[model samples]
Target: MMTYQKMICDGFELNYCIKGQGQPILVVGSSVYYPRLFSENFSQHFQLIFLDHRGFGKPTRAFKQADYTLDKIVEDIEHARQILKLDDLIIAGHSGHAFMAVAYAKAYPQHVQKMILLNTATTNSQERQQQSLSYFEAYASAKRKHQFQQDIALLEQDLKREPERRFVHMCIRMGAHSFYDYTFNATSTWDGVYPNMEIIDYLWGVAFAEQNLLQQIHHLNMPIFVGLGRYDYLVAPVSLWDAMECTPHVKKVIFEKSGHNPMLEEPEYFDEQLIAWINEG
Candidate 1:
């Protein structure tokens, strides 16, 4: 692993951690909720670059929802590429960031060599919203209310002192949708309140209002690989399976013992799968 480096893009100082060498693989982090999970877990295989999008992480800017959108995210990514002097990059994303990855491939198909999606939803509109609601309902039903409240209490106690604490609480309720697992869950206590305002708005918009990338998946000119966690609370594994089977350009692997945050849950296992996909590419 290497030291964390900072890069300036669009007037914002983006913080990222890089490691290894060879083909550049830029990781689009999941909005604000869990920013550093993927970069820390998968930095060994490729020249991994994990960045904190605007309003999230440690960016020197205030939270702004209008600036949070797929188009803007794509722009930031291109700026990052320019800074890195990367021509053929492999882009990967999880959760909401996945939409940005797929959309970027759609907008600039020639720039990206490959893509990796983890627990992503390519569908737009009511389908995604209703499905997410169902996922949370199922998760809620399976767990005890007291336990859920306990988690919330932990989160509140931990983040209450942070400046952006309210944003974290909002992000947790919105991103996780109060659908928590009984056994494995990361609270604001463990990770603190770090949801990016832009990430939240963009994800909510695309998941509820915006072609998302469902129709655009077929348009990708690069090899696409999907990593799905077997017990993901946010996105069902079957969703990825169906998407892979439906898209001729997609290859998929399932992490049988993992949940929504596979990279965090099983780092070595997740990296192995990513390496296998890159080698296949």
Candidate 2:
């Protein structure tokens, strides 16, 4: 793989790696991992351009507040596109990056040839059923509530007396849960590390903003493909599948045994499916 760096937006410089040689296809990494996570086998086919989203792999100043929104990330993607001088490029992103891809397609429909959204759903769908919202709310809230109780216990026992103590415990617990959920539900084998504080803050800030991106997806005008793992708990697969069915010029595919990270769990098959979709587009 060939690795390089590019200055995309103010306060953010990206570390990206590319492999193979052909039409450019940029792969956006998941929320907590860098692009180095993509399989080498998949990179041998289409040129795979993997990017470390802002505040992830390398050091950079972060947006202090809500400025770390998905819209800002979409702007970074466009900036990267221009830097690469790419046209008719294919865009792919996993998990949260899926929202970024959709936003990119919406902002630069003419520049993108096709888009692949993996393990993600529409966040701002007006027609989205209330049941789905209740499900996600309940799930996230439950997890947070449980963690809150642990925090209380830790504090009461004086195990976490320092101000930073609570932060460290929460971060470690969140990382553990995220990693565990991804491994068991998604992959049989794994290799990677959690992102640092800069990336974590950016993630926390954008989590909700990206969740409400269905309206943007509905407005997208490019040929798009939505792929999901049947058992994905991190994202509302049903909502995404439903949105794909409703959106025009789009197709949906599901990997039954996979979960949040199909590319890692089912790399060979994922590459084949993606290649076929790219050719068809």
Candidate 3:
């Protein structure tokens, strides 16, 4: 069973959920879409805490675009930790959230016992962006051409018809291209997910443009586990190599048959690797 909780952190009414009962690990970022899908297995071995970042998941206080900086977001995590009375947690994040995990570990090294970065990169490079776009074009030209085109068309139509739902529609479209195995229904994956467009727009658009953590990651001396999907073009697989190069103490795994969400794509292997890494001394 999962227990929902809330706290006032850094002037934001933060919402979080707790499950299982062992070593505590805080999983942050983008819980709006498929929150449970990523951490279901980890819950068995660890007390997984999931939190909705500022401007997301119904925060108590409204925020401005200037409030979404990496530093402020990290501060929110720390404030929540202090409020919850958690000690030396294992911090984990996925995609851009994984970048947040890296930044958090860098700023508050004393508070984090370990760090887990999933399907993420250190910086958003133009080379990576081009490669991702090229991969998508090639993918669309392949056997799934018709289906890919249809998904894009549907996404564009949704954006025009319901601009407020742009975040949801964008995620669905991105998931279609991000996943290697498209057998899973995209809409079903997005079920129960509530996205805050304002948060997505401000953070990813404005703040991320000025954010880069490559130089700071080397300062972290804690055990770091990085996972990347072979088919992940959104962030590019090369970013995994870049992360491994920058961080001194690190272990990496590549999900060959999976894409962005390896936990969902390859659960059994992901769980085994995660447990073994956590137990390693």
Candidate 4:
């Protein structure tokens, strides 16, 4: 059985779920999207701890723009770890959350035995942004030619009217194009978790304006696993390549048949790779 619980960390009520047994692996990301996805297969091999960041899941209060910095997020993770009395943790993060995981491991390296970064982008380079935009444009054009133009039109209109819903709508529309294989249903992969737009707006907007972590990550000396999807145009596989060049102790895995979401696109392969990496030590 899974245990759902909450803890007061630095005056904030952080929510987390714990399951399985054996080595502890703390997954810091959007729990609503990845909770069951990680637990279903990982529980048998490791104790999985899924925690929601501020303004996500069951946070005590809504987030303010000033409180959305990467340092603040890392502090929250550390506080949670101390409160839970966890030691020798293996931390993992995906997409935006990967930034937090990296920062946390850097600040508290003694606590983390290993680190996993999945489909993570370290910088908002113009070339990467253009690549993503181009992929979306091509995808839309192809879908429009297939009689799906009406759906595209409606999505654009929805974004224009309710700009705050951009993240939600973008995820829905892009999921279709982001997957390398069409056999997997994207709908089932969605966990129906509403993203904190405030958090998204501030971090991706102001926080990323003058910040890049490609160089800072070189400080990580622990066994680091970097997983990327070959078709992940949103973040681009080059980000992982760039990271691999900087970190001396690093392992890279590229999912040929997946996109930004390898776990959903190829669950069996993802599970096998993750378990093998964990057991490598």
Candidate 5:
């Protein structure tokens, strides 16, 4: 692993940690959280670097609304890339972080060699939220639904108790919906990860909700891999992705037995698919 580096921009102490060798894939989400999600052995197949944006990275101060805007976050990524001199990158982002990867690609296409967007939503809009709910209601097993209800019932009290940990609390409470194994505890993945709910509210609930990344830019040209878990309900469903304008360059693959964090739940298969995609490109 290379030395962990931090870049301060827009009052956010952005972190980027490099590990492994080969094609560089800038993993955008959390320096702590995403690093734990990927197989540590990925160091052999590619140069995987995990990065933190405002929502997941430590903030120097409370951000004014403009400070945490999507445009600024995209530029923050560019700034990190330039400062680190990352060249011909295969930028990757999981879940909502995929928005940053797409936005960065659109803004600085020359810097990107390819893309790997994992378990991302097409749109984070209310309609999509409702669709996810309906899917859960209609298809989820009674056992899963029961666990979800029982687990979510504790969220209110948990949040009230540790207001600062709202994000971690919610994710931990949503284990039934997040992992293939209903009782899988995600506390480890989020152990040292800091979440700024203020920034998350704007980015996940507002900024990303209004944008459709697939339709955001045309002629991206590079091979873009979209990996989804068959059981991931936290983000938009696979059907929504199927409805999008999937150009020839976009390759979407679904993991049959995994949930939101497929790389961890199915590490070997994830590495195989990801490496094959990289090699194919």
Candidate 6:
């Protein structure tokens, strides 16, 4: 772990931790959480700064639905960028955070040099979610399916016992779908995470679900990397992304032996591919 820091805003505080050196990469997600997901060796090729978006930073004051909308979240990222005095940065995100990263790039393309998205699906609509479920049923090993069943059987009980920690409990329970090694325990990775369910549910279920990303992505001229895990069943099928074409230098890389968190599950290969892409014209 590295030394942690904070960039407090008007109503909330975005915690950030920094490491590595070279080109700056602003990772848009939980400051504490995202930093743990990438390889430290990334410092050799880039400066990795993991900063939280408004959603993960849980403000004490009351906020309306309008406060945490995708636009607002993207602005929060811009706020962090300006505060840190970062320019021509590489914006990166994992999973749902990828929405914020891409949205930021769309809204402020001038500040971005490139973009990196890992384990990010095209959308999070009900249809996509259902597709992932069906894909899991059709493709997952029997052993993996069994573990999912076992984990899910306990989900309701866990949620009931800890309602405030609903998001964390559900993620922990979904180990089968989230990690390539279905039996792997990921509770430690989520140790200090505190999610605001209202913001998270709206963003994951609504904002990203209806996002017209292709049109927005087409306008970004910088290089982009979309990394996906072949075994990840939590998002839309990887084929959905593979089939689509965009105007930018958008490259897709698939990690055969990983799931949702390919950067963590396949860091060496992830770093190799990512560094290569970043350094390319």
* Best by the lDDT measure: 5
Q: Write the per-residue lDDT of candidate 5 for residues 246-265, one digit (tens) a residue.
A: 47788888898899998999
Clashes in predicted model 2: 2
What's the lDDT of the predicted structure labeled candidate 2? 0.61
lDDT, candidate 4, 44-142, per-residue tens = 888888888874644455546567687788888998898779988999988777777888998999999999988877765565567766655655445
| Candidate 4 Cα outliers beyond 4 Å, as residue runs | 10-12, 57-63, 125-127, 135-152, 156-165, 182-192, 209-211, 239-247
Between 1 and 6, whose TM-score is larger? Answer: 6
Off by over 4 Å in 1: 30-42, 57-66, 124-127, 136-146, 153-163, 170-181, 185-193, 196-199, 206-208
On the 0 to 100 scale, the lDDT of residue 245 in model 6 is: 55
lDDT of 6: 0.84
Alpha-carbon local distance difference test for all models: 0.64, 0.61, 0.74, 0.72, 0.84, 0.84
What's the best-to-worst order under lDDT?
5, 6, 3, 4, 1, 2
Q: Each candidate's root-mean-square deviation in Å?
A: 4.0, 6.0, 2.4, 3.3, 1.6, 1.6
Q: Compute the lDDT for candidate 1.
A: 0.64
Q: What's model 2's lDDT at 176?
A: 16
lDDT of 1 by residue, 216-275 (tens): 677676988887776655555246357457666787777766656677667788787778
User: Could you give candidate 6's per-residue lDDT for residues 1-281 as a string of tens digits?
Assistant: 36578876657777888887777888888877777788877766777888887778858577889888999988888888888899999998788888888889888999998888888777878888899999999999999999989998998897788777788888888999988899988888888888888888999999999875555566678888888898888884788785545444888888998999888899899889888888885
Per-residue error (Å), model 6, residue 223:
0.7
- Give one clash count per candidate, in the order shown: 1, 2, 0, 0, 0, 0
